[model samples]
Target chain A: MNEIRIFSPATVANVSCGFDVMGFCLDSVGDEMVIRKVERKGIHITRIEGFDLPYEAEKNVSGVSALAMYDAIDVDFGFEIEIYKKIKPGSGIGSSAASAVGSVFGMNELLGRPFNKTQLTEFAIKGEALASKCEHADNLAPAMFGGFALVKSVSPLVILEIPSPEDLYATIIHPQIEIKTAESRALLPKEVALQDATTQWANFGSLIHGLHTGDFEVIKNALHDVIVEPHRSKLIPYFNEVTKAAINAGALGSGISGSGPSIFSLSKGIENAINVKDAIEKVYAKTGIDFDIHVSKINSKGIKIIN
Target chain B: MNEIRIFSPATVANVSCGFDVMGFCLDSVGDEMVIRKVERKGIHITRIEGFDLPYEAEKNVSGVSALAMYDAIDVDFGFEIEIYKKIKPGSGIGSSAASAVGSVFGMNELLGRPFNKTQLTEFAIKGEALASKCEHADNLAPAMFGGFALVKSVSPLVILEIPSPEDLYATIIHPQIEIKTAESRALLPKEVALQDATTQWANFGSLIHGLHTGDFEVIKNALHDVIVEPHRSKLIPYFNEVTKAAINAGALGSGISGSGPSIFSLSKGIENAINVKDAIEKVYAKTGIDFDIHVSKINSKGIKIIN
Candidate 1:
């Protein structure tokens, strides 16, 4: 094939108690990219649409991820790429990961799929590195594999796909505000109280158990973030009010999505997801934050070829 | 209904990555208790067998647990108990939990079962408080509920029973050495590096995913302890050697069972569990530590009435 179009789903990283480790793909919001094989011996970005991101190939996340993949397989193919950035940058919902994951995902297909999911993940994390000065797969893995994922180890790159309950729905509220991922991360403590860490991991363990067993009660009880949320929630306006509204609206659990400005809640079904969105909007509407609400089931089929 | 006999299985708490939160039960090693309802109006330990545990009603773990249950129910009936200590105390396993669980379990049967598992767990944790300085259900929950458990919160008493893979087996090596639980716990840092805590919880998340999905490779990859084990492993003799031997013998993972004299390894089946035992014995036999090895399937039944 001369060209392929791929859509990479937006993802919520650090899903509450599982900071820097857990993430899930979302169906409603995503980024689209088109890669076409060209006679030129070098990669080029033909056009960048929808956002005012850098056009320099070396600086863009997609370009960096493609370069990583090219280095990994030593491929001789050159491609022209067009990025349709639908997932807004600095959205705290893995906008960069979509570009990173989409680039490598498309590159693997264009190079006859030499790399596996894990290998592709390794190259894709470079996109995060370019964006945040650190390589983390919490976002990239879910964007590539779909569903819930646990990045067990980053060095050897062990990412496990956790089972998502079939009845689960995701409700995300992006308040049209920017919280830079790097700055949000910098807000976290360099050290944590041992007791708080224990509690956090305990919640993390329960969350994974709940996801696998489809026990909504366990998930509800375990959706606590003692480590990151306390530090990052202050950056988002009305975080506590919005989260409480989602929970009161029958969300199984709710917390800041990624670094926030976007808060998400997991519900048992679509109707409850809409309810949670409406409730959070009520809280945000009073603040006049110009928000967008997304209600969708978890995107379990991550980045996919459109045509 | 005059007398009852109950056995509570021993447990491996902390389970590498889940310090103070996760634990699983063992079938082969346990404690046995016999409770007889008497005409008196208070709880009493009439006979203590097999070990020189404190006979004082408030001092003993079993006594404390029984008293806690009595206080909760405000029972008027008195009970006399006999204890047979099989699980060694200060061996890093849930020896005290077995006693606490067995006493409450036997007492509940004697009283026509007034409380459920969670209620029983609450009373049982009082035994831990009596034994140590604080109330923790990491050991008691698994012993009472069976299989793997995550103590999501100790304050609200949230304990979730995690599903266990049927093929999983546990191999434990109690090397006739005692590491006082208090001292071992004291060895832990009051605070931990944020990066290490994140890695530990990430592993905890993956481990739960592996257990729920029955993915052995994910379990193997996630069987890491970056928090407590690094600090406590130094207290155990041949900790590194025994762990390596178990891994070489095809054990999926191995680590300090709780807070150090006992080390446990998990394997896929009975054969591998026994193989792990043999390998560990080869290392410990040279040390002349008078070790005892128990290889058993993951005990799904926690406290059972033997009648």
Candidate 2:
């Protein structure tokens, strides 16, 4: 078998009410993992890029995903995986998902595509679950299909590819800090008030409609997160300032992007998106937090060989 | 004005998450109202058709709405009103709203368009408070606009027109019975469980997206009305059968039309719509009470005047 160089774009999961159900892949921002087949049956992953957080096959996302796929199928050969981690962990940008998706997708080519995208999605889910402690599909769908896709129901793994609006621009500002999924989940209330719960769903419904129709105004109106954002906002140093600045700079809506420390804002066009990034970065800069801004459209192309 | 003839269509209010803020007009059955300026300075009631209703200027809907508009805007001439009721009252259909909108619309024409449709919407809102004791805009937007519209904010009255998907069919079946609005509304709890409310909103958000994108599958999946339907289902006889039957008959989704005694269902095409109607009506027929079935497309056109 031949060696393949593959890149899986980072994703934003739980795009407001989408919770484990919605996500979109970023075009240029993500992790790149490369895999090569060997003669014997086993999995080997060398750290080419990305932080070497854990190395055990069960503990490492990239290795575990490839190992699971190969073990389940009739693969007599082994594979070595390498990753280029451009998106930092805990960026609320689905860095973990990119690694797992990259592993499965890169290995599929070496195996002659024995499994469909859903089967590959399962492999990714199992791998990512080791870190997040929850089996959710929000992160996997975006990495699989790219662009703005909805994991309508994850039981059978259904993907709804919503037509990305012409002017849809994602202005993601990753504040240089870490807010792990565990701590972010810990800050939330076990039970929320009924009214707040209703508000969340209303926002969720509005966001879904907004994403589907590309109705920027509706998305703006519905960009509220009563449950998670309010509770988790304090975890970020300048959460309110960044969100307000982005909105003031013509962003359609801004929120804590999935267990955020790295806040993301969705804007209408490139100009507004840039303005949002500049404004948000200014506030974070004052806080002495280094940040990176990515201005891109919905990555309609999910996993690919970038190098 | 020489003469005024106006027809307002039936409307589905509280469309999913829009419980009170959203509604859309139906293309099929509604109410027809006609008014002519008389020489006298005071309004007079001439005739009523299609259903048994009151004729007094103070007690009747047409008389009350026409009187309100006349008082709000200066009218030098008196007028005679005629109403042909098509949508039965207390069917959870916009029965009272149709009359109110028609009166407001008909009078504006009789007075030579002193008030625009937007201005007349306020008068219609007044009628809503008069009937339901709650000021809701779900019915008013559709009644005035002719198609799918949203009541953005009621105090200032912002009615945003949302695009209606072309491939949609609404099947309305009015069971032969009555559930008074007060009684049905009474069944609802002011405070709901947090989890249930969240589910409702999520469903609602998806429903809105479905409406904008013309995705019937999303609409079907997101149609569970946990807040209103579950509690209110006990009021109508064989409610579960009707809903289950409509869904089983290929309906995109089904919910109580207004409050109940009427069930509203959606399908992708005309054939499925007819099937849903037949399936639901077959159950009501066995109870020895005939029901009215309305098969229609989403009314992109709200109110119309044909002489």
Candidate 3:
């Protein structure tokens, strides 16, 4: 009860039509973290492997989120954290979110689950803000609650967990390049055309309906981003080609995963997802870009206890 | 079947967050029309009653939609329409849509139902455009398909019929004022702040989810119009007071019914709807506006066969 190990999932935010509001978790891509309660009265980061990130407890994402959760609780004992970061930071697949959610989720479990998912998401976004320079729950909610999550509102913190289809799979390609979330977000216009906004909401509503009804054709037709992708895609090399390749290879839909450098496509099954991954890989290979491709089932469980 | 008699329900469109895409049909507010097949090869409006309207088939809302549908099919006989209109034009409770849907729905039945609902909507919106000066399916889809409907897209014509909660009811108050749909639409800004747009889509997506799950609290919270109501409410006298009265009297949500002079509020049951109606009537009565209030259950069947 004093110690916990958990798998915190990588997630794809922005999901085309649902920019800034929707996301889905990945089962095969994540980071593992171990948290142990200590007698000391402060949070500590004992170890971090596989990625060179800030180790200072005050500066780290996991530490910042854990501290937020810690300050709100009356726990006498402190927590020691060790992270095995597999999802690379700035790859646009919610690496910071995985770490952010990991700390809060693990800490909550060790404290006998004092906080609900929404509260955990609230704490996690404080950490997420450190990385994105914005407090958004799109990635944090899905990584903490799993399946497809829609951050309905951040102020009151309403998060709806949309049902993921049984056979839904994702193919993600993380190009070995960094596109800072803050910089990519800065490229977006402060205002959008009302007509374009209308189209975006229509598509977003349709996509949610499609997910609920498990209609692939509706999903494909509705998964389009008219607001953010056009500007952000310019930051990532060969974004259009990769998306085309994914769709042509049978993905239900494809788009820039988050603030880009990573692109994701959703398909109906693992086989189709593999095909999409291969198609994307072929395109990325020709671009002479080093990349990592992952084919994964949509994670139904967000953060899992790993004994 | 050489002739058909039908009741075409009026609709409330742009339901708060779902501006331009969402609507619901009403049981008590509608128009009744009778259509007969004739040897002549054209559409004709044979009789006019209850409300003064254009008798010419080319100019009348019903006749215009009937012609659109009539020309598309290779029907052997022309159609004669007798209209008993109950909904008032420029009232903004989709009077044009009821008429438009009435013709197409009655024609489809008289011809042994040749066209599907989507095709019928296509014809109906042609007539709606004549009144509103824009082609929108929010009202038409609900009028044709009944209950709650989302016009996911207008061009490709994807309509999603959302299930209404069993106990849902509507209260509508028409203040006997005129607000042209075209003029109201012209009042909207060409562009909107990205933050407002994001909030709008969030509420929209949440509203859809709330409807699907039948969660009243979620519906109440999500039933906000940040994008349109602020500007359009100015045209409707005592708009704020009426809305506040409805909410205070236990209506789930209230907003301008279509491009309003008519204000609509949805409540959980008939009793609440009546209470809301009384409350709205009280507010409008003090303003010296001649108003008509109607309380009815949600219409599950759109264009019903009367005889």
Best by lDDT: 3
Q: After superposition, how far is residue B155 of candidate 1 from its true place, in Å?
A: 2.1
Q: Stretches of candidate 2 above 4 Å error?
A: A17-20, A112-116, A186-215, B15-18, B38-80, B108-120, B150-167, B189-202, B209-215
Positional deviation of residue B89's Cα in model 1 after best superposition, in angstroms: 2.1
Tens-place lDDT digits, model 1, residues A106-197? 87788778889999989888877898788898889999999998898899898888887898999998889877767787899999999999
What docking class should model 2 receive?
A: acceptable
Count clashing residue pairs in model 1.
Answer: 0
Over 4 Å off, model 1: A74-76, B74-76
Give the Cα lDDT of each candidate. 0.88, 0.76, 0.90
Clashing pairs in 2: A147-A299, A205-B205, B92-B258, B146-B301, B146-B302
Candidate 3 per-residue C-alpha lDDT over B1-307 given as tens digits, one digit per residue, 9 for 90 to 100: 8888989898999999898899999999899999988999899899988888889988998998998998898867799999999998888888899999998898888777788999999999889888777889899999999999999899989999887688999999999887766679788989999889989998888888888888888888888999899999999999999999999999999998888988899899889999998898889889988999999888988889986
lDDT of 2 by residue, A48-145 (tens): 55565675667787777777787787757778777778878778888778888888898887777888887898888888887688777778878888
Which RMSD does model 3 reach against the true structure? Answer: 1.1
Q: Best-fitting candidate, measured by DockQ?
A: 1
DockQ of each: 0.90, 0.35, 0.84
In model 3, residue pairs whose N, Cα or C atoms come closer than 3 Å (at least 3 residues apart or on different chains), thus clashing, are none
- Model 3, which residues run further than 4 Å from truth? none
Question: Is 1 or 2 the stronger prediction by lDDT?
Answer: 1
